[model samples]
Structures are given as structure tokens and as C-alpha cells.
Target: MLVPLTREKFEQLIPLIATGPQYKYYWGKFSNFLQRLLISVVIGAIVLLFKVLFRVDFPLVFIIGIIGAFYWFWGPVFQASQRNIKCRRYKYSGFFRGRILDFWITEELIGKQETVNNKGDLVIVENREKRINLEIGDDTGFIAEFQAPLKVAYKAISSGQWAELLVMSNRGDLSTIEEISDIYIPSRDLWVSDYPILRRDFFTEVSSRLDDNEDEDDKPRRRRSEGNRRRKRDDYRY
Candidate 1:
């Protein structure tokens, strides 16, 4: 089940949501210029073939160029728009607080010796991504991996600090980080401020559901304890 928030509450949180990285269409690691050109050429070839075989007068360049732009550029822009919109509907999926347990950048070499006419010359390429492992909720035992952006949250990562991570639980477990900020651990003696309340509340929201399961597990033990106490009392009465 997802947490319910009023429109006004969602609006209040929207600004904070804006603080996170806006949606970006995850275009595969293929370079933009190559993607565009290859797509355009394929589309152009098809358009030209159709024009020749069917004896159509349409200019192949115009048809293919427009289609290429749509697929390579406009399509992704539209997808990004839809993703951010979907975020509104799934807002509850974005609220989770965790302690950063570990962080690492994924590095792999990509080799592409073929396609000579394509953009830049690169026989060997290296890919990198920041992978952050987090321990969520009161159950410090609960852990998950989030593929976060390397450019953001370097200081906190280096300092080994706790964070209020607004993560997106996509298809599976919470894997993508939507936003993150360093949160100073509040001293218990000090009053938790508004921000602190927001911090504490979101974490509780994520972890509280688990507490229900814990409650279910404790019932048997609790009953046994109660039984033991009653038995002891009866013995004393005798």
C-alpha cells in the first residue's frame, strides 16, 4: 500500500521534489550523434525504398529527417515529460530515508570497432555510475542498493553521513535515487524541528509497515508470556 497525501501536501512536497534531478530519458550509452545518424539513415533508406518501389513523389529527405528527429530527440523529450508526470501519481514511492552504507562507481570497458562512418573514433570506452548501498528504517538490518548519480552528494558520501534519500521504487525494489540530502542526526534532547519532523515521518512511513509484521510475530510470544504470568499467579494463590 502507498502513503496518501492531499493535493496541498503534495504541492508542498513538490518544491522539494523539484530539488531532485528532473526526469531524463535513459537513452542507452550510445553517443547521441551516432544514435541520431543511424536512426536517420535507416528511416531514410526505408522511405527511399518505398518512394522508388511505389512511385511516390514525396521527398525522402523530408520524411526521413522529420521521423529521425522524432525518434532520436522529440520522442525522448516526450517520455521525460511523462515520467515526471507519473512521479506525481506515484509520489509515495519517492519517500524513504536511509543511512549510506557504501558507495562505488561501476566501471566497464565498451568496445565498438565497427561502424566506421559513425561519429567519434573510439575502440575502447569506459562507463561509470555511482552505486550507493543503503540501510533503511529502524531495522538497520534492512538494506538496499540505489544507483545514484555520481555528480551529486559527494561530500556526504565521503563523510559517511546519514541521509534523507527520496528514492524511486520502480519495477522492483527501491533502486533509483530521485533526490538525496545530508541530514544531521538530531540529538534526542533537542526538539525536532519542522525539517526533522519531515525526516522522521518519512522514515517511519517506510519502516512502519514492517513494524506490522513484527507485531504479528510478537503476538505469540506475548501470549506465552501472559500465560506464564497467569500460571505463576495461580501457583501463588494455591
Candidate 2:
């Protein structure tokens, strides 16, 4: 079942949604550049050590110059040039459909649902247990299983509601999800091409509901004031 919030709440919560991949790509490139820069420094130091130890006529000036050029120019240039490089585009035709709403997980509940396919006398069974439920928060409140929970969480950081998440699992367990809030999402690489329309719809409904609630709250006050005015007129006439 999709749950809708009022407009005010939707607006407040919309900001909490994770950011798209475009933002992640930018940061990812910057991080890669920093890593490369560090590696280059280490390589330069090794080259310097080799020149001193071997007493070889290594062109230290030329090598250092190239490294410097890569650091100051090539790194940023390569990153900027690749900005327009398209990775993979998802076609929203069939097979994959539906938008992602709110994602939540409780440690207490494991996979409970399972299904079987019927074929004549024999049947093939499979465990369709849901470890994570992605809430589309709409009229139906559609919930779906998230196959890649960690990736979903990473995407959620960009969506803006990273603080609401609380991950818990056993210590030393690599598969366990850990709660780490206030995480900065790297750039564009973090997003998928297929945008979740369900999430958008959910927020729209939430915003509408909030507006309705506000109107309802004002109605009673308006009626009370009108009643008081009527009572005052009656008292004066009497």
C-alpha cells in the first residue's frame, strides 16, 4: 500500500530524498583524481631514489615536469573531457517497471514470503523472501524487494533522507548493513538512468494531503469566529 503525505510534509521530505547520479559522478571523478595524484607523488619519489642509488643520468627534470603537468592539467582535463561520456542507458520499455518510493528495513523480520510454480504433478519451489522493502508510498503503497540493498542505500544518500536510515547487524559480519549517516555522495555515477516516477507521485500526493489538512484546521477557527459574531448581535438586540 502506498502512503501519501500532505504537501507540507512532502516538501519537507522531498529534500531528504537522495540526489541523482549526476551529482555522484562529479565527486567520483574528483576522488579518483586525488587518488591518482597521490600515486603519482609516490612514483616520483621512487624515481628520485633510483637515480641517486644507480648514479644513472635519469632525466629527473623531464619526469618531474611531466608528473607536474599531469597533476595540474591532465587530471582535471581528463575528468572534464569524460563528463559527456555516456555509460549505459536503461530503456524503460518492459520487464523493468515502477518507481522507487521510500526504503525501510527492520532487523527483526527476515524473509517470510515464498512461492512455488505448478507444472502438472510436480512443482518447482523458490524462496522469494524480502530482505528489504522499497515503499512506493502511493495509493496502493506498492512494496518491492531490493536485490541490492547496499546499492539502494548508497542511492538513498543522494535522495536526501540518509539520516532516517538505521542499519544494524552482527559484528564482524561482512554482509550486515551498517548505519552511517551524514555521508557525502560522490558525483553522477551514483544514479541510474531510469527515474522513479512512483517516488515523484508519492511526494505529490503527500504535498496535497498536507494542504488539505491545513485547510481543515482553518475551517473550525473560521466557524468559531462567525458564531461569536452572531451571538454578539443577538445580545445587543435583546
Q: Pick the candidate with the highest TM-score.
A: 1
Clashes of each: 0, 34
Residue 30 error for model 2, in Å? 11
For model 2 the local lDDT of residue 4 reads 22
C-alpha lDDT of candidate 2 relative to the true structure: 0.36
Residue 98 lDDT in candidate 1: 47
Candidate 2 wrong stretches, greater than 4 Å: 1-38, 57-95, 105-238
For model 1, how does the per-residue alpha-carbon lDDT over 1-238 read when each residue is reduced to its tens digit? 1122334443343333222122232343458646766776787677777767887786665666467645765544444445445555543344333454655665333333343335766444335444333333423354444443334434334323444433443333334434332232222212111122123344444345434543664675555565764453333210
Angstrom error at residue 82, model 1: 7.6
Candidate 2 C-alpha lDDT tens digits along 1-238 = 1122223332232233233432343335566768867866776677667667876775765577467546633554444334322111111111111344555544433345444546445443443433333432123332233422234544343232211111122332213323211111123323222222123333344334444644664675555565764453333210
Candidate 2 least-lDDT 10 residues: 87-96
TM-score of each: 0.41, 0.24
Q: Give the TM-score of candidate 1.
A: 0.41
